[model samples]
Structure formats: structure tokens, C-alpha cells
Target: MRLFIRLLLIPGIVGWLLGGCSEKIDPKPATYSQLLTGTDKKSWKIVSYQVLDNGNASSVIPAQSGLDACIADDILTFYADAEHKLEVSQNAIICYPNEPDIYVTDTWTLFNANASLEFYLPVLNGKFPWTIKNLTATVLTIEYYFPDINASYRFTFNSTTTK
Candidate 1:
């Protein structure tokens, strides 16, 4: 009888202790925006571009193409005519091997001048071994990697005001 009581009590105590120690996790919300540009005139140029980290470089878009730039508080917004109509948006938490606790949200709109269509894509930002940074004003560069596809891409932007 004592043995049976001891076994039952031990199990009950262990279960209660474990249950009480469990922690609750909260889900993070996604971010999205639909911004309207004001009358303030600004322009950006794709002066030079490169895909990935390769040494090769290309001209920023075409010469006659139109580019736009807008500033919103802490973030700068760039817009171009979406002939391709590609748009993407996503939210993700990154657990980088070297740097943890990194979180990012990304949205991209792709347009092809010849295709007369657009691509809208949203993906969770990933943390890579190489740090990703953004440079704005005269030039802006964004680096991203896709874990699902095992690929990475880079975009460069250049901005100038028309007098």
C-alpha cells in the first residue's frame, strides 16, 4: 500500500511541477503598408547593379526609365512603374548561427519592361552568415537569401533629384 501511494504521489508531483514550469509563447504579427506619394518630387536612378556578391556589375535599369523616391519616417520608400506587377511581402524571425534574435520583414515588387506583367512576392527575411545592410540616398543596396530555394539576390538603387 505504501509503495503504491508513493508511486502515485511521485508521478502526480512530477507532472504538476513540469506543467507549472511550462512557458507561454506569443506569436508575432505581420507588417504591411499601402503608401501614397505626396506632391514632393524626388527621383532615384539604378546607376549600377549586381546580382549576388559576384564581382560583375551592370547598369542600373535603363537610362530613360523613370524612378521615384519617397521618405516615410524611419524608412525610405522607392517606387517604379510596375510593368511586371510583381509584389511580395513577408515577416520572419531569424535565428542566425552567429547572431541570434534578428527579425525582419520584406516585401518586393518586380516588373519586367518587356513582359508587360509584374510579380508580387512576400517572403520571410533570412539571416545569412554574411551580414545584410542597406545603403540609401545616392545608392541603396539590399541583400537577401532564400533558404527554400538555396539562392540569394542583390538589388542596387541610385537616387537623384531633377531640377
Candidate 2:
């Protein structure tokens, strides 16, 4: 009876030790590109736009800057494709009723070691470049300099969807 009990205890201890040695699989961390475009696409909405003077915040959006309230409803989406497509949509409230809901479809590029971005701006009729200040799974911040005004503008966006 003592020998049989020892045999059963040996198998249980061996099994427990084997289970402890098993490897755990963890999901891979997302890359910078993946954070911007998610698996295939990502949508973002403007949270705050700030005017910086000499690296200091001078003014804010809406009341201070007199920015149209409708601008907050706009959605910007980035697609992970060969062209790096971008789409801007006027969501909820349309700033300009005469304009279409889909405001613009343009190509975007990430350069400067993925620290900067360049995209077409229909309003300016030229390519606009911005420095990527910060990017995370839920937030993105970008800065643009206006040489004429001698000021920098920072735009912060909140992620609406990662699809």
C-alpha cells in the first residue's frame, strides 16, 4: 500500500512540473504604422487645436480662436495601403452645407523616420507637412508651422475607431 501511494504521487508531481515549464504566448506589440492605421484603417476626430507662439500656447480652438463648432464633428481616416489613402468626412454637423459629406480623398505619406507626415490639402491647394508630436492607441498629436505667421499650430485628435 505504501509503494502504490508513492507511485501515484510521483506522476502528479511530474505533471505539475511539466505544466510550469510550458511557454506563454503574448500578442505582438503594435508598430507605429499599426497604431496609425490599425489592422487596415483608423478613424480620428479633432479634440483640440492649439496655436503656439514661441513654443507656448497662445490660443485654443472654438471660443478663443473662433473656430467653427462644426469642425469638431469632422472625421479623418487613414488607410494602410500602398497609396496610404486619407479620407476626411463631415460628420454630424456640416460646416458648409454646399460642400459634400466626403470632403476630401487624398494621398498621405509618412517620412522623416515616421516622425513627419505630408498630405494634400484641398483648401490650400498644396501639400501640407506636419510633425508627429505624439501617437498612441487612443490619441494622436501633430504640429504644423506657419512661416508667414511665425507660429506653430498643434492639433490633437482622439481615435474613434481602429478597424
Candidate 3:
């Protein structure tokens, strides 16, 4: 009787241990807006900027495009609020001495089923639309075309913070 009881307990113990190792339920995937803004806000820093001609990478910024190096450290943040505020922080470096450290704009929208982002820049005095090439938890790629130059600029940004 003792041996039989021991065999029964061994199986029960093994089964309980295996049950504890089962996979946990996964949370739902985040939406585009959630990925862009995170829980409350998110900050992104440019990793690469390339100029495209006829859908080909012709040159890279700051090397052939004459873009300032200061732009690489800037942080673009989006807030998940009623206004959907957008802000850019010119960290440590600024292209111009008179430029402000932070630029804020309330006029921003995610349109075309959240496949595109449009934001108004007071300094530029116009609203610009960027095609959302890709947006993930860690990376965001957007493209903008300049009609006058007949070229497209692709910007890849890495998420600095997503909270």
C-alpha cells in the first residue's frame, strides 16, 4: 500500500509542476496610435535620413544632403491626449543659435486609417504629410516628398522612450 501511494503522489506532483510551466496568456496587440504614443507619450530620435530619387536612395543626409548634424539628437514626442499634441526637443544642439529648445504644435492628425501622419509646423508655416512607411514598438519610418525637388526623403527613427 505504501508503494502504491508513492506512485500516485509522484504523478500528481509531476502533473502539477508541468501545469505551472504552461504559457501565460498574452496581452492584446497595440494599435497604431498606441504604438506611436505608447501609454501616455513616446519619444523618437532620428537614426537615418536618406534622400531618394526615383525610389532609389541617392544620398544620405548630413553627408550629401547638407542637413545639420544637430538634427540627429532631436527628440520628437507625441502625446496621447485630447489635443494629440506633438513636440520636438532640440537636445543639447541646435542648428541655429536663436532656435528654441522645444517646439510644440497642437495641430497634428493621424489620417488615412492611421497610415499617414500630418503635422503643422509654425516655423515652416505649412502642414506637411508624411507617409508612414513603418511603425513598430522600436522603430518608425516615415517618408516625405518635395514636389519642387522631385525627390523623397526617408527618415528612420528609433524609440527612445515609450511611456
Candidate 4:
């Protein structure tokens, strides 16, 4: 009697928990066109930047921006100006790491490498924490958190033709 009732309850509870856990959460990336168009441009700003390892401990490179966009090959040139303590430095660096293992693909991968970290460009009057994921063209979704503070910006790129 009691054993039979316990068995029934156990199955019901287990099913309920599993069902709740099955919901998928997908976060998308913003598109290159959208970025160029400045559709959601207000969400970000070019604040004082730093080039550091993913651990946020070691400083690989300092701040100074003079990046030339090469949409043809998806490259950004980090020209070494006087601010960067150089004058005739003009070279293009791959936006992401060259290695497939370090670079993120179709999945959400996190790296703990010496020089791999997600950078956040500051936003004027921005006061929220957010995340970007599921990078697609049709959808750009952003979510916010407590005190309505947590906010996320999604970005996606179409072409690799940066030149």
C-alpha cells in the first residue's frame, strides 16, 4: 500500500524535475552588418582598452587605438603609434586566434589561455551586466539582470573578407 504510493510519487517528481531542466537557453551573436550600421551601437563604446592575458593578470599590450578595418579578411591593424610607444608599426592581427582549438566555433567555448579573454568595450551611461551568444543574422537578443542592471549584447559577423 505505502510502497506503491511512494513509487508513484517518486516517478512523478523525477519527471517534473527532468522536464524543468530540459529547457534550452540560446544566446546569439550580433552581425557584422549590424555593427557597421550602428543599429545597437549605443550599447558599446571605445573606452580605454587593454591587451592582457585571459587571466587578467599579465599585461601583454597596452592601450591605444588606431585600428583599420579590413572587412575582407576580418582583420584589424594594430598600428604602433607614439601612444603605443612606436611610430612605424603597422601590422594586422587576426581578430581571433589562428588555432581552431582556441577560437570558438559553433559552440559556446571558454578559454583560459594566456592571451584569450572576452573584451568589453565601455558604453556611455551603461550599467548592466550581459552576455552574447547563439550568433545568427536574423535574431539579436539582449537580456538584463537585477536592479535591471544585467544586460547582454549579441553580435554576429557575416564575411571574413577583411582587408
Question: Against the true structure, whose lDDT is highest?
Answer: 2
By descending lDDT, how would the candidates be arranged?
Answer: 2, 3, 1, 4
Each model's lDDT: 0.34, 0.79, 0.76, 0.29
lDDT of 4 at 119: 29
Q: Model 2: clashing residue pairs?
A: none
What TM-score goes with each of the models?
Answer: 0.27, 0.72, 0.68, 0.22
Error of 1 at 56 (Å): 12
**Candidate RMSDs in order:** 17.4, 4.5, 5.3, 17.7
Total backbone collisions for each predicted model: 16, 0, 0, 27
Model 4: ten consecutive residues of lowest lDDT: 82-91
Best by TM-score: 2
Candidate 1 structure quality by residue, lDDT tens digits, 64-92:
23222111001223333332121121113
lDDT of 2 by residue, 111-148 (tens): 85858888653323467898889989998888888878
Off by over 4 Å in 2: 1-27, 59-66, 112-114, 120-126, 147-150
